[model samples]
Target: MDKLRRVLSGQEENEERGLTSQVLDASSLSYSTRVKWFFICFVAGILLSILGTALLFIPGGGFKLFAVFYTLGNLAALGSTCFLMGPLKQLKRMFEPTRLIATIVMLLCFVLTLCAVFWWDKKPLAILFCVLQFLAMTWYSISYIPFARDAVMKCFTTCLS
Candidate 1:
């Protein structure tokens, strides 16, 4: 009722809005617009990741290119979620107890992957970090679905047994 009235009146309630909320609201991005951007960013991220994989076949500098593109792609895909849940909320959720370790590992992998490729000049180390990044990202993503991690653990144990 109050929400409907506020919407119809073209006025925001007198509640205190944070800077992030105010900026998002000022941009006038409708829900549909946010969804559209999210998909666009997500698809672009996937394409970049695929391109990086393809570049791995190329000789000289292939590893470097792959590391850079793959890292950027992961970052883009991770950031796309911010459109659905505003940045602050997305960040808060990311660091929640359930996902803290996964998020930290994924972020650390991103940094180490870049460092291994650029500064350390270690292709194998960069590739290893990228693999870890993928696994951490997968774990982090599954954390969002109820019982997903438990199910995965069960499956792994079953396979081992």
Candidate 2:
């Protein structure tokens, strides 16, 4: 009840953590804090995606497991992408108009794929949607990988140590 009220009121307090976190109001976040969250979320997305992909390749994994992991992976990737796009948009030369359009298209595909997963009754349509989603994901990966490689490498190194 307290948490719900805080969220609705646009102010939050994390008593267990000894923290009082404000809601993401327009004036709340600093530039560095936003950037920190972006990197953190991106790293998490990469880890989830890798784990999910590994599950897909297990020899005896059932369709249900595959779908679960795939959905989780894609959802994470989509979230990270959303975070990154904000900063990426600020780069005038690096992110051209066409690139922004492509990013928007990829976001759309991710959403459609998520919806298709819920429509399991229409197997044919689901398969087609999945295929299209895969293509869009693949295309986005080409651009996203370069940006994420450093973060992923650092995350792995930190985890190993």
Candidate 3:
């Protein structure tokens, strides 16, 4: 992060600080606050995806509810990742509106999975959907690791014991 800071400080380029690292470092909630929730939601999403896919195999599984759930959740994940593309810096944030939004998206996805899980047919499609859903889950967890590391470093340097 200091490297990023130094880099942004124009130590490398001899210019102004870049917005990329700053935004990444400035997430609304601290890394600690988000870590548990991110992992929990990501894991839950993966599980729901698998269950939904499995449900498709159950012969009556491709219900509108489940389809909506799986599709919408996956799309939401795609949108969530967009947040990663923002600049990285210390935001000195107060409330986390993004988290609330994420929660709503995740909840909707969860309900959709329930619809899929209750199905009685369509195993192959179910598995496919689950695999894709899991991919999104994995991405959310994996991509955030680097950002989390930066946040941790920020806390270490800025916090007093």
- TM-score leader: 1
Q: Candidate 2, residue 134: CA error in Å?
A: 5.1
- How would you encode candidate 3's per-residue C-alpha lDDT over 41-156 as one tens digit per residue? 54555565455445544555345445655555554444433333321211111113533343344444444444444563444454454555454444334333557646755787
TM-score of each model, in listed order? 0.86, 0.44, 0.33
Return the candidate ranking by TM-score, descending.
1, 2, 3
The full ranking of all candidates by lDDT, starting with the best, is 1, 2, 3
Task: TM-score for candidate 2, please give it.
Answer: 0.44
**Per-residue lDDT of 102-126 in model 1, one digit per residue for the tens?**
9999999999999999999998899
How many clashes in candidate 3? 26
Of candidate 2, the 10-residue stretch with the lowest lDDT total is 18-27
CA lDDT of every candidate: 0.92, 0.57, 0.48
